[model samples]
Target: MVPRRILLETGLECFRESLNDLHAPATCATHLIGCVTTIFNFPPSTPRSNAEMDVMVKAVEKHYEFLNLAVSFVAVPRTSRQLLKLTTDLAKCDCPMSHPGSTQLHDLGQHWVNDMACKDVTTLLYFLLFVPSAILKGVNKTRVAKGSNKHWPRSISDIVPFGFDALVEALSQWTVVLANPIPLLFLGDALHVCGRPLFTAVTTSPTFMDRLISLLRITCANMRRPQKSEQLPVSYFYIIAVFLFHVMAQRTSQNSIMIWVRGRELELYPILSEAVTITKDPKLWPRTVQRDATGIAMIVNIFHAFAFHFSKDVPRPPGLHPELAPARESPEIEPVIRLYDLLSTRRDECYAPGCMRSLQEVGHAFQKCGACRKVTYCSKACQGADWKNTEYPHKLICRQLQSFIAASGSATGHPKDNFFEDFDQAEAEAVTAPLLAWVKARDAQKELQDLEKSMRGLAKTEKDEGAVEMIPDLRSNS
Candidate 1:
């Protein structure tokens, strides 16, 4: 019965020597894996709180001699599935290679790093970069020699033992296993990344976005409970809302969200209310501190009804829903840049309503909106229709986009990340009108639920309701 502190100190000493000296990388990796497996793996049976458990687990990772210098044990054995989790904590950090003249790291005669001064996640990435490709090749070799003619399963995610940490890493390893020849990562911006046929196959699949939404619903459900039994940390949910806004938050999902959202507003409202409600709970998240998760749960979930996009589209309409846009004194926003200034921005389709023509079909000729200059039109007619059309008219939002452009100029304009970094009162008030509406709807819902519970004469609390097994599935359903 050795003290845990002694084990910790001894392990740290061993880990320091192993990493700094580059002395037997495999042995060190295996040792740390065992340490992490025994000391860090959280079972429901564990006595400690999740916060204390998290602190202990994070203790294994330490800063080395240099400031940004850190390392991770990346020699993953196929059998040890729990150690593969690199979400929540690692996703926020980016890995960049160090300078030219530092001690080069060599593993099996191959240089893994030129210098030691790199972030912990970077070290993980460096080692993991090759391991996945190798594992993939070895798997193929086994299949080939065995004369197995079975094609890769479409439900590859269901069969995979580990949930991949990075989406790129997943694509790299799983795509090879799934036998996709093209690499989608190297393709440039969001437009290019979303456009690839192989990428589209996964994104455009009927079940893809449905699965994503279900998982989000499941997490939100878990958070509503009193206990700390979460499938994922808050950060992952924040990232999902920000990155997948087109699918998750947007109203127009007809052409492509790329798959599921499909403008089903009823299916969206319940989750949004739950997400906002949970983040407001002091028992769940601290009231004094502001979390990006709370901000995200607010910003993205604020009325799915396009409140943020109203500046002034047309003359007074009788029965339009009220929005949180600025007061309507401003004139028509003149376009900022000329035809040469459009910058292509990798857009393939026109921004105007009812314009189905692609860049390819339209001979790559498109004109920029004069006011905001952010939107492009395939022709003058479609642009005109989008501006004045009563239903979801683009005319209302043009000046708002123009204002964003004005605020977000390059070296010439204010920084894009300024007000958004903190997600303060100013930002909250900007969307305050619709957010208030959402709060009212949620209150109404709570009253109805309470009434129903009273009629039933009994109801289990949320804790009891969420006590069922709800392990999160972050794995891509390829």
Candidate 2:
């Protein structure tokens, strides 16, 4: 026996290094397998408590996050498949070579991530910036190529066990992030960067969302039982709810909206509400809301549903759902600017005479302009005035802005004047109202086009006196 303690330490060290420098794939694999085997079969000879195990695992996870970051910036070998296989094999390996938990490594990675919900908007913001940038590409590539329904971790049976309610709660936390404007914007941009065509497979696929929802609900309902060995039950209901809202809010796949909600609610609500209402009359309902594997699974599924949209082969609703169609919210907002607009703006900015010399941009020196005290400027004069006539509107706005602002807390107008007090309360209306806005914008564009066409016809008819007008100019003004 190679001293179980020594083997565990060596394996853990290698696993850490592999995740830290993901480029060293072979080394990572060897270390990961070796460490897991030692832990499972031999158990640390000196013995270790659950807390110590958690510390070690957390250290490894931090390295994993770093690896994900590095991999996002640089290209790597076809490690997705290799990693999947290694993890799968490790899951099945006999004592001293696999993770000790009932759920396999695959299940742990697949589901446990959201077990401890995001603590606050800041963490959610970090998730927005880091997660999509890191995982979208890899997820899309693997999903598109394999057309596998396998989610993150490929198999939840390989890691820590979770239940559905836990899953739903975990996912709900992520939903709260998406509902935040700043994080939502970046995540949406990342989704766009990952592109739509690739996502068709996931959104459109039959049973992907449905199956995931079912799995999460079943898992979450059974979280408290120790007898339920194997699958970590974490209900994915909340995540599913959040996902359905996001996809439907964006008007992506109308097909799955009702099905996902109905199915998940049927499976999850009874259990989740129990967890949610546990605080009601604590004398009567004593169980705290701490969730098990099933609950966590549900949560992961919810986020996974929308996140699946980033992968290829997720189907879209070919046409809007009948109930969702006609006079409802609009689809997602258009790109912030058009290509023509960007080109024109860039050209004008570069060529304009008397343009501000102190505009802050990448590669420019970072400094605060004295006059505005809000906007960044390389020089004092540029910050002092926007124009001689209009006054410094930007400065005034910036002066009133607070540095430590939550996405929801930054309110505009007087409390009495502004109807909406907080972003969270306002999101439902703000997001849904865009549909009406889209319709108005669309109708306006059509009117303009029709007017232009009529004008062109009038011009042509005038040039050719021999021609007779078959149709009258039907401009609204006319």
Candidate 3:
């Protein structure tokens, strides 16, 4: 048997060779992934010194650069438009068993189609999961203090050359891939790995925010449609709800809530309601429900709070159904309500100690600090005065304040584990009762309208038949 040192050396050399080969990118990627996986899962029997382990870790660090190169070689488009086109192509090519002609297709051909459609996305998912672990493997724990920013695990984007725009574009591409449930599970894992940064980037972009919200709305809307409901992946919808929940929690502005609500509280409510329904469905994944419970609750409660907050300024949508309003608020939603109240109240207070300018007094005209966004000033002069002040200068503690707000939003005193330990099925149903009732009432209303229209059409037809019969009699008399 070859010596262990030689084996590791040989593996390292092979990995290096693969990275240098530009022509055979797929081959290189496959080889590099194999080598990196082996290094990460290095066997105990293979004796190695600490120095040797460090060497192996350093070797694996190159994997990120190689991954970006491999992706580039695959010709994955960089621009949003091109990525969208790619997404469309993949979605169209994904053949479900229910699709006509899918059954008759040869197994090999079907497999080829599946691979072609899923290749890039699967590669991306693997990169997201593996690269972070690889980078951390080489990190010196002794040098990094516990609870320090350095000790906190970094995202794949933090290590790689991939920009925020590229990450968002990749996420957009996966939004289309979600049409197929099988690939969507993988996409969810990828999202979990990169979700924090992606959420931050998405919150900053109005266009991306709109696209994501539209995707959620369309997906949930499809779930409500009888013809399309079976084809719809309810699990994917749950994943999206979780994603949206994260986005909503981190959003720096209340306007984000309004933008998402978009006068469609009637439509948005059921989606949250159904998410709660799916969470309790024994046949589905319960962990998804647990993971998403806070977000779902937060959004539903935020909707309620915003409705009350903007009741006067934002005119109620025309023909707003009474059933859409909650019959009664649940105590469980109080935390979210309190959070919103706190946010709204805090925005009115000037960050500067001496200045007294309120958001209520001036409205959205108040200027928020560009960096942390935790502070607002009524004018540039107030902002300048606050920044230059010797006592509690805004510049000194802006990042700390921003961090505090971020932490509060994410934590929210919600227990991550055993989320439903004390909460029973009966209680779950009780909390969701209003939303479920609204959905039922809306659906019933639709069915009633459809029935009435059908009846009206039938009566018109009968009248036309009688008129036709009279026409012949009139002709005979004439």
Give the candidate number with the greatest TM-score.
3
TM-score of each: 0.36, 0.31, 0.40
Residue lDDT tens for model 3, 1-478: 4444544454444444543543332222223433434434433222236555555455555454444443332223345565454434433333333322222222323333233333433433343343343344334322221222242232343322355455455556545544332322322333333333444555455455445545656555555454532322444554454344334443445565565445555554554455445434444543232344644444344444444432323544443323224333434443343232223323444556576544433434466789866477878888888987754466655654455444443343324232222222223333344324433443454465566566667667888788322212221332
Task: Residues 87-169, candidate 1: write the lDDT tens digits.
Answer: 22332422121312111111211221212222333333323222222122113222322334143211222112232223333
Off by over 4 Å in 1: 1-203, 221-232, 248-273, 286-289, 292-348, 356-366, 378-426, 430-478
Report lDDT (Cα) of residue 216, candidate 3: 58
Output candidate 1 Cα RMSD. 22.0
By TM-score, the better pick of 1 and 2 is 1
What's the count of clashing pairs in each model shown? 7, 82, 0
Clashing pairs in 3: none
TM-score, candidate 2, is 0.31
> What would the per-residue lDDT of candidate 2 be over residues 1-478, giving only the tens digit for each residue?
4454555455555445445543333332223433343333322231236444444333333334333332231222323454344334433323233433322432322222233232222222333233323333223322322333244322221111132222222223333322222222223322222223213333444534444444444434444344433221222234334333334333323344444444343333333334333212233221443544443333333333333333223333323222212212223322112111111112111112233231112223434434422234434454445423132234323322222112112232223223222322243333224333433444564565667777777878876977654554454553
Candidate 1 positional error at 80, Å: 15
Q: Distance from true position, residue 398, model 3, in Å?
A: 19
